[model samples]
Target: MKTNFLFTMLTGLLLFTACSEKPATTYTINGTIPDNSLDGKMIYIYNRDNNNLNIDSTVVTGTTFTFTGKMDTAAYCRIDASREYYVNFILENGTINLDLSKPVSPSGSPLNDEIARFFAAQDSMSDLIDSKRQEFMKQTEDKEERMKLQKDFFQNEWKPAYLAMLDGFFDRNLNNPIGGMALNYMDGYLSTDQIKAKLSLLSEPVRNTPSMQERLQRFDALEKTAEGKPFTDFTIETEDGNKVSLSDYVGKGKYTLVDFWASWCGPCRAETPVLAEVYNQYKNKGLEVLGVAVWDSPENTKKAIEELKITWPQILNAGEKPTKLYGINGIPHIILFGPDGTIIARDLRGDGLKAKVKEVIETK
Candidate 1:
């Protein structure tokens, strides 16, 4: 009996030792590349959440490379062998296997597996849509009719399905990096209120991340500049080294068309002629057009103005100041301000721009 008791005690001690020696929570990436030329090359993993800084690196030994790190929380990162070859994945506590040979494949981790499933679903839907588009193109000979049908299919059918899938993804990852990533992608698809609802569902720690905080601030700015809200004033220095306030042009007893654009933006350039036409038609009849060059260098702005024949008074070198104030995410964002500086309409472009200006100026 004593011998049996001694054996049981020994077994318990062994079990305790085994449990105590277990490794702590950490992540490891086991990666492989098939190209023989890159056997001795360097592999880098960048933390995209933190200014895309290199968080870890390794030398490719033979055709394989490995990286291991302890993460307090999950982060979005990318593994790059070169600019041409990179795969973005969530770095979490688990072993992740990546094959960067023919196509990038990330597996063997929970979040990575989820990402694979998400992408597969997206691709399948995209393929289905493309097939429908091709079939419709064959049947519909009229160019305008084909384009209209395609637009309806994409908007009414495919987009809702895509958004629903994304909603499921976000719902599954409300407290993780994946949720934050999902929110970032939903900006163009979802309305501001919808995004706000999704963001509110996240935990405090996830919502307070730098990227998420920036999204929150942008939403606030959007609210401040919604249609009918008074225009927010800001100042920027022009290419001529003169300081100018948006107030200098806006709220000066005339309807002002404020264009927040960049020199490198194609759509902005295309819309310039439309703006010039409107200005010429109505400048003598209570209209003023102001060009605020944003997200471009002074040299490029001046060159674009000369090439595009933009004779309107321009505020150059504005950078991100005006965009942030107005929550303008894309270039060619044009706002029509009332004579007293109240925002009349926004997001004007093409014929719609001309129509809005004409309606207001002619009636005045």
Candidate 2:
């Protein structure tokens, strides 16, 4: 009996030691905004991976606040102080301090330190791009000269340098879950090979994440729908209880443009006049413009069409499925399909849109 009791005490001590050695799952955040103007204002914490916002909100009291919670992984989170002010850092199982002054950043965690370096490099590249763009815009008054500014700026300056910077950090933090955040910066800019290379930089487990899978799928869809390929066919139920198919408009012996837009999309609305001009100039010259409203409500779709005087044949309530099929992750995604239903150009914005339309219209 004494031997059994001694064994039980030893087992208890072993169990206690095991528990103590295990890593802590919960995280604590103590913040100081240092801006009294934000005193009593609400700060929202957003999970960058799955859902942005709707997680938690806390009130700032005298430039200080605290947040404590746990996450499944070393997920990245951004603190929203205002629309114009925010700071992003990894939410790991440790105390973190956020600085809200000019050049906002976070500290007190290893992931936060990595993110600081990453953000600094990104901000510098972005600032240089912005400065050059502003300088070019201010210097040029010629519409034709100004038209080439964006294309030139991105290809010549931003893409190479920005991607090189990413290559460095992604190489350094390949094992860290924060490395997954690099995917957010790459949209339509990176090619399949480049994207896959970056994805390979992430740890194996992270490569299997749902978000990563969706991104890969989107990239695949984009590749299949690339310019010079055959246009993808789609059909949607219109607001008036009629079925509208892409075949009915596109590939029926006319150059057809499908403007994938939503009512709530500001960029889409801004391009309304542009679309109107092109439709007017080219409709009589074998051009057809169709509006497919996705990621919007029926009421809003009708409201925008009426307000903007959108006379083009519109497919209302198109929703997300069509976008998923075409790999359109964002709004204002415009595609120009040839008479034989081959894609001529895609994602054409501003001057590129006008040029493409005019070029095709003049060709035939």
Top-lDDT structure, candidate number: 1
lDDT assessment of candidate 2: 0.77
Task: Quantify all predictions' global Cα lDDT against the true fold.
Answer: 0.81, 0.77
The reply for model 1, stretches above 4 Å from the true place, is 1-24, 36-43, 101-104
Candidate 2 per-residue lDDT over residues 1-364, each given as its tens digit? 1323323433321221112344657878888765677888888787666556446678888878888887667766778786555777777887788876633478777677677767766666677667777887898987678758766767765676666565656666666655676665764577778888778778876676667778888878888888999977788877667888888888999998899999999999998899999999999999999998999998999999999999999888888877987888888999999999999999878789999999998977
Residue ranges of candidate 2 with Cα displaced over 4 Å:
1-26, 33-45, 53-63, 69-72, 80-86, 99-104, 132-159, 240-242, 354-364
Residue pairs clashing, model 1: none
Displacement of the residue 304 alpha carbon in candidate 1, Å: 1.5
